[model samples]
Target chain A: MTQETITTDVVIIGAGPVGLFAVFELGLLDLKCHLVDILDKPGGQCAELYPEKPIYDIPGLPVVSGQELTERLMEQAAPFNPEYHYNEMVEELRKNEDGSFHLKTDGGLTFHAKAVVIAAGGGSFQPKKPPIPGIEAYEGKSVFYSVKRMEDFRGKNILISGGGDSALDWTINLEPIANSMQLIHRRDGFRAAPDSVNKMHALVEEQKMKFHLGQITELHGDNGQLTGVSVKGNDGEIFQVECDTLLPFFGLTMKLGPIANWGINLNENLIPVDTEKFVTDAEGIYAIGDINTYPGKLKLILSGFHEAALMAQAAKRYIDPEAKVTFQYTTSSTSLQKKLGVA
Target chain B: MHIVLVDGHGAEHKLEALEGWRVMEIIRDHGYPIVAECGGACACGTCQVEVDPNWAAKLHEPREDELDMLDENYGGEWSRLSCQILMSEELDGLRVRLAPISVKEAA
Candidate 1:
């Protein structure tokens, strides 16, 4: 929780493919970058949503998985030694009196940067809450999206929902401490790893925990404290399951959080930026990737890559107005090759 | 081909559908509210829709991967990821309601 301020040449607000590529483009010009992402990993949607899914239109690479692209981008940007601050969302952004920008993350870290790059693909990834009515009332008190501390659930009755890895993993991890543990899902089938699923079944077979085939329909609680949940079974039977704590792992979804509060003009949840330079309405602040919009904007990864290259040049000039930026290709420029450590 | 879409407010809008295009794409292209976060990869279940029970029998059963995604996203008996539903002559005039989760909440 220490309020420490870090100084950097540029601060990128996302660690997605475009943000990672921005490091290479900015690094080529000797501008050090620090990237902050809400997800725990470097790749944004590529890592979270469909890491194993194949992408076809990356150019030159006929086909590649989302994860492989992220790895290659990280490797390509590695020579620059870009600093990554994962699991932190840029919460506050302000322009300094001297024209430099100041940024703060939800994790308490702050940054003072000459330029800011908004490569946030679809804003931040937030846990998807179940559509159960009144579920928000119990959130943070007795309903938790993620487990921060296992000890907090000791001696409590817990009901876990969803059939994903997060749900199964937490059920096994928290079974030992809970007085009673129950798992509910729309179907008996699980998307989690086989090993974890087996372990959960073993716990259920031993009468240590209970597994129910149903989806949560209603939450019953009082004053932010959950008492039980009403579940609709796969057979259309409605039943009540008693639990002091409810954990619904419905996976993650993207939201345009905090970014709307910024002064940047937004067009239907996307930042409006120029085709050239990709600069936003705010000076020294640039937008790229899917989060940005223009007259003929196409939300494509290759488009974001092109935008990154242009943004780097504009950012460098904005940081130092007298600085001369000569356009050179990585294949021909000895200086660029040296920077990429291939010389 | 066309399909009837019931929005979040229960307003029905008939939208033209293209052959071989996903129902999610049709809804999105017609300026309807749908996240389709994964862009038809069938990875995210944010593009969920509630198929009319009469029309549900006309469509093919969901695969294991789709079921897995639906299980994680609180999909019910009539729930199906619209991204997995490809439009065809048989699915013309299909009726489906957008799930509450699929529509973006008013900011």
Candidate 2:
């Protein structure tokens, strides 16, 4: 890994709606931002968990889908040209004597920033692994938690587990190119969209692929080159499913992950911050969104948006101590509009 | 300002508090045993507290979301999510008792 270091005015963690809004807020002040997220995309929970779920609490907008909200936020922050490093988890965060933060990601990327914003909503979303012995050995080779590329599964016998959108979506996506495709779950019920599930059933009826009602029991592979898998049916029959690739989507769980080790004070796994600037006990580090706790803090996207506004103001002062601070609204500030490319 | 917090064990402790901070923040900041699993989102009722009967009438009415959470997870008199209660000068003498289901009990 190269030891080169990248510098930015501010480094915002998590690319959720709040983090995306932080880009806009900080960008308006002429401070560049870089956002890091564990997921491959920008929207955190909203995009991963419930992209199509309708959200009614966002102010002004009477109704909006989770995916739409993420899209709009990304659009609003587009002019800022915020750097997004997706599919990477921040592994280390340390304070330098110079009062700036030195950060490192699991993907071997590094950054130095004058200010840091923790916009991670309820921490990082970790994939739930199935209960199979020695499954770790096959991970990253034949077994995968998420599909990053469709071409990787091309011409391979792929067996996908789980009944969620990820499983069904991948099943539909990889069907055309795979040598053979099979889907397995505990039962016939699926938590995925009905339309997708229907399409999967239609495909199965046409003999394009196979669907099995069973749970993964064992792996039939050596040295990570999966040859096949053992499946135990609900009716107590054990059978082998031939496949070289496995994709399991058991859903996701939230964990504070490495953020708990950053020397920041955590109250029951949530960061504590002051209401004024939403800054944590650690100087130069600000916590916004669901990851932060304060008196009367509302863990809503709208509340995070408000916190991002104040956080940008405080972050500006921290980055430029001698600079004059002026409050300007997007509706009235010509400079802000120009930065947004709308003036 | 100072506010009184009655722990789950019925021990009362007074702590310094800020005027604009949330009651949940004050409790958590002092290392009080409360679990805000969802932070202040009002989605998880882990931070539930029973406002002192007398003070309940003095505080603002719970919001619609707050009410939905209370109705869904907790149904007790004066039960409120401390995160939803903002501290103010009028709330200086606020007295809140920890509900039966705190982070400790839930965990």
Candidate 3:
């Protein structure tokens, strides 16, 4: 396959609020940007983890949910028409000899950019696996952590373990297609929304599927394929739940991922960035948002916004070494207003 | 001052802390495994930690906002948002365990 290469002025690694804001800031300076995210959509952790959760500290918007904040940020950057490549992660980053950066993602897409921005909020969101004995053997086979494709388990015996929204939502989504479905959890208490809980209960009452109060103790299968699982019930009884496919929604955990392999300096698992321009140890590369750390750094969206503004300035200078750059406000600068389509 | 942070794997790490710095900053600066999703704004409770019972008395009471956020996190008696706890000379040698993160899985 001929790998497609996209050449751009700025390459942002995350599509979260800060990354989106970076596009606007860079866009105002007439710089083009292409964003890549591991997630299937923008908003990073905000959209993936807690879309409905309200965030009370986004400065101007006294109260905004994570999803709303993401939408508004996208709208704010729409005039720039930043290119986004979702459902992919940047696996490798190398600096070209000519001072440009080369990046490749897990999906085989490559980008060459004059400047690179790391706005990854809390790194990559990885699925938390259930701490079951010998469970690792079944991973990627019968035991799956996430439902990337709904049709993978079609007509298979599916067992979902968790009392959270993912478990309940998948139970509802996969019940009809699954040959036999069993929803298992430690107890009747659920952390999912009330409506989902109600729907799950209604399905259970109708005998469309079964619900068990237990925890997975062991996986029963051969060579990565599962035939059943040993479940320890709340009443201290161990029983076998037969299923060919197991989906455990243990929630998500943040991993620094491939960025850790990059040669940039790291403080803890975060990138150490200079506060002046939010630039990392590497030239023409900047780290912002929760992924970057500095003295007295606050991992707030507003702080990332401030960092994006400064980062754009530094990036502009790096992209055009001999050009004179001036600071201007959108409210008064006709040129800035023209870029935003407001003049 | 220095403090000890216990990660999910039961490993202990000693880290430097500055006076007036939020506990979240110290742990985060060192790349320990606590997620302060809202930074230090006291909005998100992703930075919850269990203070050592012995040192719990030395900590200040959680404000109403912090308490409310903790309630949202289903906090217990020992639960406190690391963002709300400021480091001071008095807080030296503090040992804290990360609160197990329990997030509702979204579809």
- TM-scores for candidates 1 onward, in order: 0.98, 0.68, 0.79
Per-residue lDDT tens digits of candidate 1, residues A12-114? 9999999999999999999999999999998888999889989999999999999999999999999999999999999999998999999999989999999
Which portions of model 3 miss their true places by more than 4 Å?
A: A1-3, A191-195, B1-107
Which of 1 and 3 is the better model by DockQ? Answer: 1
Output the chain A TM-score of model 3: 0.93
Candidate 2 contains a number of clashing pairs equal to: 3
On residues A248-340, what C-alpha lDDT tens digit does candidate 3 reach at each position?
Answer: 886665678899888998877789888998899998999998889999987788999999999999999999989889889899999999999
Clashing pairs in 1: none
Candidate 1 residue A31 C-alpha distance from true site, Å? 0.6
Q: What's the lDDT for residue A114 in model 2?
A: 96
Q: Model 1 chain B — which ten-residue stretch has the worst lDDT?
A: B98-107
Q: In order, what DockQ does each candidate have?
A: 0.75, 0.04, 0.11
The CAPRI-style docking tier of model 3 reads: incorrect
Candidate 1 local distance difference test against the native: 0.92
Candidate 2 per-residue lDDT, tens place, B16-74, comes to 99989989989998998786655565655668899999999988887755664453332
Question: Alpha carbon lDDT of residue A178, candidate 1?
Answer: 96
Q: Please report, in order, the local distance difference test score of every candidate based on alpha carbons.
A: 0.92, 0.86, 0.85
lDDT of 1 at B10: 88
